[model samples]
Target: MPDITHEEWLRRAESWKVSGAHHIDGADEPGGGATFTVVSPRDGRVLAEVADGGTAEVDAAVAAARRAFDTGPWPRLAPAERGRVLLRIADLLEERREELALTVSLEMGKPVTEAYAIELRAVIGTFRWYGHLADKLTDESPHTPQDALALVTREATGVVGAVVPWNFPLTLAGWKVAPALAAGCTVVLKPSENSPLSALLLGRIATEAGLPPGALNVVAGNGPVAGRALGLHPDVDVLAFTGSTAVGRHFLHYAADSNLKRVWLELGGKSPNIILPDAPDLAKAAATAAWGIFFNQGEMCTAPSRLLVHSSVAEQVTDAIVARADALRVGDPLDPATEMGALVSAGHLGRVLDHVGTGLDEGARLRAGGERTLTGTGGSYLRPTVFDRVAPGMRLSREEIFGPVLSVLTFDDLDEAVALANATEYGLAAGLWTSDLSTAHRVSRALKAGTVWVNCYEEGDLSVPFGGMKQSGNGRDKSVHALEKYTELKTTWIQL
Candidate 1:
């Protein structure tokens, strides 16, 4: 298939002006009172003006979803019927992959090539995977006494409140929506105001793919208003969220106070990449580390922000990492050849720079890329930043900057490395680079993270579960485990 041209992509994006908000009951409803502008991070251009949906809008979407779940045609359809519609949706998504990738890049400032390769591919795969699994997940009867048969069944948690973040909007939305739809649940999705375009377009695509009225909804608004409303809505049976730790906590609180609904959150992280002295190739290790933290402008929740190196190889690894970080190409996200794009926005860029300043104040040495503004750019760009001699308790070490900033710290031994890696309260993910079998096995077992890579960083597969431990929040996002969160398992007993 031919790649989507920049001009064609722009024209298609512009055509989505009327589709930005309140997709409820199979129709678009304009905002009642407030509006917000979605800007392109590449040049601070206004991409579109979206309705800042509030309580009223959220209520309408949720009510629509509830009605669909209770009395609409979506839930009443046979599992095979639902699966057929979802498969059709997958086919439509594949047909427009290039356009969706361009939309993701324009609105979120991700490198276009990376957007196509990473986000779009993953999202399309998610839909196809779940579509196939929908009918296969039907309840089965276990062999037992003739009079007492056990039926193990799974049913959808009605009216899912899916709140996705701006960084990876479509991919995250797919994570929530595909499984929920597969399990026969209707959804009221609230996309982050910063990047609502892709989700809005996805909503339109669902309509074209034969998704019944009210089966899926999208509301574009800020977290304080629309997000809070969805979290607290009584009819919402399950809440699936991906964002910062603070907001995840607030959502949990709201779920408790409002309706005691089931909640699933994939929150923030300060993941560590431990480089041991026995690493096979220092250059490869350094390159993977750079890609792990710097890719997507370090906006991923499970970014490997902390680099724990063995004392013996600290200097060599740090020098290699610095070289790789300096070589990154920073430019406009729309340019197909651009390797690094701007931060999501100027405000987020400023916050990342502020964290760099804090690192300096707390005694971490600014090794490279700490200066802001690439020589010729005016957009929200921050040079890839690296900090050396970072202590465990420093602000840069403890907090998540969510930018192209990396912290380097050294450890004398395996025990020390594991200790340093697990020191943080946030245990989302960790990466270890070592050729020693015992060391890899021991450290991987000891690391307090939900996912660990022995010789790689940020390597994820759809079949494996993805989530976090501790304050990073609970619940898995991918795999069959994710399907469980969207469903409620019921047990039935019979008297013979």
Candidate 2:
């Protein structure tokens, strides 16, 4: 990398901001729109401003998408042709990776290195994966009698409304956009007002990559205004969302209240990280446990916030985890050496602090951290907290606390562990560490989550389907499974 100082990178990020109106149909629209100010959580300074879109902008964007799907060349093109456009988009994103990643860090307060390395890389990979998968989608022909032939195929679901949260803005938006485009659907994406810079830039990149005027559109604003507009838009055939469970329900209501559009959600999680008695390496598991909860400042929906350790090795693992948590460095996100960064906003930081106080009140013993830090500009950073001897009913144990806090609980046997792990209202993702193959298989089946990591945490493969069970929300995000959610099945019968 260049010897780019932190201030220089911050300058680079601010320089890339879009001062124009939202991208509607391959061009910048007029700018009499309401604007949303972007603030840097690292120091509480104004970074940039985005056109705060609402129902009127949403109607225009969705109408553009619907027109592109119904009459434009985008849906009329062959699948491979669409794939080529997506590949071009991937190339453009890869070329401007540093700028996009820096924008995410400035807007959402994650470490720049993580935003670039992990999140942006995944963004490119998702587009590329679906780009390749597009041409491979073929019609299914089932066996039939001599006089009849059955042809089954999938078709696009028209316009998609994608409302993404600030936590993993670009990549989570990728989860919706890639598959929908590959399935030959047009999209109107509403990125969170808190983190709209990258998605707005994406609109220009997609247009530059040879997409049609209305193939992709972006409306940036608060959820109540822009997000609800997408959900309630009659032309929008599907709504894909990634955020809190509290906000996820609003989309369902919008869908029902309007056209009953298909809604795909990847919501919050209070996932379990289990370390069995026969865990291969307790120390290694301990280190991973710390990373599992503390990574991204624990802004991950699939974070293993609830650590369930076998009683035989609970103290050993707990102490090791505490040591690792204490070693984390909380500082400015632009600093490449920093391990943790600030929350996305002051409101989010307050939510996290309130959860910490509730953990103390509910009697979860604070083993490591539970205080605010980096309060010079505003209280945006918190030390990675570890609470031990937590019971089942504690809010920190049962509910989703989307922050860098770990609640450690103990279990005596496999049955008890399964019971405790499956106790939460969420079923997003879970992790287990054990050497025995039988134990791994048995416990994985018993747990009630969409994805389970045996001895690892938050590891993702582009081809694997990702979503959750129960209240963690519906539908898949990656792989061919995601494509299914964006398209509808049709069967054609012909007499020979």
Looking at candidate 1, what is the lDDT of residue 58?
91
Which digits, one per residue and each the tens of the lDDT, describe model 1 over residues 240-330? 9999999999998999899999999898899999998788888899889988888999898888899999889889888988888888888
Error of 1 at 143 (Å): 5.7
Error of 1 at 91 (Å): 1.7
For model 2, state the Cα shift of residue 350 in Å.
0.5
Each model's lDDT: 0.87, 0.89
Q: lDDT of candidate 2 vs native? A: 0.89
Model 1 spans > 4 angstroms off: 1-18, 138-146, 374-378
TM-score for candidate 2, residues paired by index:
0.98
How many Å off is the CA of 374 in candidate 1?
Answer: 4.5
Using lDDT as the measure, the top candidate is: 2
Q: Give lDDT: candidate 1, residue 277.
A: 79
Best by TM-score: 2
lDDT of 2 by residue, 391-493 (tens): 9998888878899999999999889999999998899999999999998999899999999999888886987889999999999989899988899999999
